[model samples]
Target: MKTLLMGTAVLAVTASTAFAAGHSVVRLGTEGAYPPYNYLDDAGEVAGFERELGDELCARAEMTCEWVTNDWDSIIPNLVSGNYDAIIAGMSITDEREEVVDFTQNYTPPSPSAYVAMSEDADIAGGVIAAQTGTIQAAHVAESGATLLEYPTPDETIAAVMSGEADAVMADKDFLIPLVEENSGMVFVGDDVPLGGGIGMAFRESDPEMREAFDSAIQTMKDDGTLNEMIVKWLGEDSPRF
Candidate 1:
């Protein structure tokens, strides 16, 4: 799970300059707290699956790009507000989100959302369940039989479960995997659920050309199998791919 801890001051300067056709400049916004997708590494730089994938897509699209870190809760609103050129975060494609922002073709397959608790004995059927607010996972929790507890960030959802404020937390399986592996106190339980279509880049509704550019670049990578290789490298062998 990822949390937002810093201000957007440095990220505000990412899209300050613009370039022409052969040297187009684009700013990519990401939540640098979700591991294997986009997260701040030990060097305090954005690193992981989306970082590698976004760089390759930029090269193929002939765009000079830079990364910008943002909190997950406000990521979409900031994109629509012109804070960045496109969102390269692992944003799932949904009709609700698509109504506000256009999305490129999916680069990653649909991901399975999972649940985990501090102990296997923890109640997951009808007890308090935690999830990040504004996400599809949170919506699902609200509709499920369990009592839903919303948090501003993904990290806080897990924190709630660990601190006994919540019985379990639901989130992307890829996100909970590494965390569960490292902490013996945590264990994944219950059947996994799939939500949304797949992960894609988001752009302002007026920027259809930007979406098409990235869509074409993603298609090129898929055709040559580069996309699949990178998916395995960062998301583990069992992760679904293009």
Candidate 2:
């Protein structure tokens, strides 16, 4: 459920040349599909929480920045290959990913992963469960007793359940809450599973300076309570704070 994607566009802001002299433009890559986090608005421009946060962080760091959209599957690889300077997608900071790229301090805390189904009695533990591929939720299902049905996008996983191909779907609780409320038939089932450490921006292993700049900006937001406020504003009142 923690998957989504969309097209690319660039938005740049002029910054203080005194603070950013000689610094290259920092490109922040996102999926531009996941709502309340990163998504493309009607204008085909990247919008939502991460967009605002990324912009603020760049401003604070005195870096001119641009937003880039890429498929979720290639977000990280693109960053490493210089397609982008950092990844601001809703990517969790996991040990496995750390082996490939460095991560800044978490911007959002880990939220519980839950199951949604047509019936509350769906066999979440042993039935077919759909999850977006390459996500922590998919990894969880592979290790759970249930059969894992993988999809490339979150919409497809929801479609799998609607078509009766899967007994249930597991995804971030925050992402599913709005969907379950909108659909009368879908209901939550089984226990809520917490996955990943939290969400963070990623940079290639060689970009320690970029990583540290963003990390410091994130910490400043945390200390001032703005990060927590943004978390609640987009994720809901029950979402965990920094």
Q: Note the Cα lDDT for every prediction shown.
A: 0.87, 0.85
Question: On a 0 to 100 scale, what is the lDDT of residue 17 in model 2?
Answer: 31
Go through the candidates in order and give the C-alpha RMSD of each one to the true structure. 5.8, 6.5
Tell me each candidate's TM-score.
0.90, 0.89
Lowest lDDT 10-residue stretch of candidate 2 = 4-13
Q: How displaced is residue 38 in candidate 1, in Å?
A: 0.8
How big is the positional error of residue 185 in model 1, measured in Å on the Cα after superposition?
A: 1.8
At residue 231, what lDDT does model 1 achieve?
91
lDDT per residue, candidate 1, 1-242, as tens digits? Answer: 12231333334333332222334888899999888799998899999999999999999998878889998889998987677889988899999999988899899999899999998888888999999988888899899899999998788898999999999999889889999999999999889999989999998776666778899999999999999999999998889997
Off by over 4 Å in 2: 1-21
Please state the error at residue 118 of candidate 2 in Å. Answer: 1.3
Task: Score candidate 2 by TM-score against the native.
Answer: 0.89
Q: Which stretches of candidate 1 lie over 4 Å from their true place?
A: 1-23
Candidate 1 worst ten-residue window by lDDT: 1-10
Which whole-number lDDT from 0 to 100 does residue 199 have in model 1?
Answer: 93
Which residue pairs clash within candidate 1? Answer: none
Candidate 1 has a TM-score of: 0.90
